[model samples]
Target: MELGLEVLGFLLTALVMIIEGIAVVMSRRPMHSILFLFLLLLTAAALFIELDAVVLALAELLIYNGGITILLTLAASIEPEEIRAPRIKPDIILPLVAAVILVFMISTYKFGNVSNFSYTSLGTFILSGYGILLLVVMVMSIAAALSATYMISKEDVGI
Candidate 1:
């Protein structure tokens, strides 16, 4: 049935979102965390799509994945290799996995049919909100990038 298939897709995307969120937070490496965070945002967009909020979904995809993650990655690139932390503790990894699985299981249950397209309804006038959001995300991304660069560049000289 169409409803069943839609629900299944939604559940799978939702599971991916939760798992990626856990991975992002649990990963010890900053670069890895940023990468997984990007994935989490993408999966979140997919979940939004299933719920029919195309506007919000696209916004998440563009702002988070398309802008912030890219900025984070750029900043991470400048991090000195020797200063980066080592691997994360397995003790934390195991519990994160368990939490992810539990979340997936609980979210599988059927909920109200959430299927409505938002982006398509906005028409050309969407330029207004779209433009504003784009400008804001760009400004924030730039600020984050500059701040990261400043942090990495700062250091106290040895006496």
Candidate 2:
């Protein structure tokens, strides 16, 4: 039963990642692509949690899914529609080159054996070190959202 559930979880995670990857690349609208990317990050975070990498999962959720996703969504919403659409057909070479570089980097990397990699409890570490930073980030995100709302609500002279 447990084994079956684990297998199901893994399958679902892989499916989510595959779907997100395809959707992100095929999406024409910038906002849609960003939304798909956010989904991808969320799936990745879930995968991390399943693997018992809770810290990594939290990082993925808090950083990419929360911070970067919000910023990208805001930018997409604020940008002109014409600019949001690709002006030129994307060149294949750039992505190909990037893929090659990524593959090479991954293949050549060496993860040295760590005999001891200990971490403090998440609660302790957060409260001792990152607690204040987290609060500040939350406040900043709220401020940004409020400012964006104000900017959008303001009457445009050109409109």
Best by TM-score: 1
Model 1 error, position 94 (Å):
18
Tell how far residue 80 is off in model 2, in angstroms: 1.7
- Against the true structure, what is every candidate's RMSD? 8.3, 11.5
Off by over 4 Å in 1: 1-3, 81-159
lDDT of 2 at 88: 27
In the range 1-159, model 1's lDDT, one tens digit per residue, is 566766776766766677667777877778878867766776676666556676687789788888889988988898765455646554555456445544543464245544543254575655665878877889998998898677768875333
Task: Give the poorly placed runs of model 2, Cα more than 4 Å off.
Answer: 1-3, 83-159
lDDT of 2 by residue, 35-60 (tens): 67876787777676666566687889
Q: How high is each candidate's TM-score? A: 0.54, 0.52
